[model samples]
Target: VKRIIALPGEHVAIRNGAVYINGQRLIEPYLSEPTLWRGMTLDHEYVVEPGHVFVMGDNRNNSSDSRVFGAVPLSSIVGKAWVTYWPPDEVQVLTTPAYAFQ
Candidate 1:
């Protein structure tokens, strides 16, 4: 449902159709396609305020998230989607992606 993009105090921006943190680009190997942001206007860099997190949708261009609603308060997070239940044969557990900004 939601993908955590940038944590509090981190800088988040969409540049050249890719996500960047601080001044380094994030390696998002899990994404099947590159992000195509089309929701809100991100003409300027965004700095995540304390106690807030920047989130996005699995479907970037069509999803509304922090880019549209602004950063979400950390306290709003209740749980993470850990597994898929549909398609009995395709059931599986999901783990958060490890990002290395470089």
Candidate 2:
């Protein structure tokens, strides 16, 4: 699965267990449960550098993403996953979330 959270030059931050971009809180309605982000970066504010992105897994507790490996270069992203067909029983088309940025 590929997650495109923060883009180059975007400011990402975590406060009270939620994500904020460019000082606006991001709304992720697709999440099955709330995210308790405890990533490798503890600076509170993460300014995504040029040609890089910040990635993370839905299962924050079990995911090791850019938080651990640092920002990922834009050149490395292959593509986005448009559908989910795993677990056999659970399969469906994926739609992009409309994050409420304030």
Candidate 3:
């Protein structure tokens, strides 16, 4: 699963199975490939509330995030994911999704 690397008040959407923030598609070089949108709604637009953020997992088809539990308030954010100590090959420092901040 991918961690939420960005915050609220940003425009986001999924198209052609790719995620776009603002107007450009995010180059998620880490993703296996284009993801599938399952159990995700594209009908209603969401404006993230102040001090809150929207989060989702990389496994879009199996994630239960803002799409299910709704936006997460900043106070609820336990902490930033700082490392990938497990699965040595996948170990690396995570970066925020750049496009999300555009």
**Local accuracy of candidate 2 as per-residue lDDT tens digits, 1-102:** 547789999998877667888988888766666555564454468889999999988876567887667789989989888888988798988887766875
Give candidate 3's root-mean-square deviation (CA, Å). 3.2
lDDT of 1 by residue, 34-86 (tens): 67556545445789999999998877778889888899999999999999787
Question: Candidates' TM-scores?
Answer: 0.85, 0.85, 0.69
Clashes of each: 0, 0, 0
Residue 89 C-alpha lDDT in model 2: 91
- How does candidate 2 fare on TM-score? 0.85
Model 1 lDDT-worst window of ten: 35-44
Identify the candidate with maximal lDDT: 1
Please give the TM-score that candidate 3 achieves against the real structure. 0.69
lDDT of 2: 0.78
Compared with the true structure, what per-residue lDDT tens digits does model 3 show for residues 1-102? Answer: 436634678666666767666646677766676654445565334566678887878666677777677778888777777667779878888666554322
Error of 2 at 81 (Å): 0.5
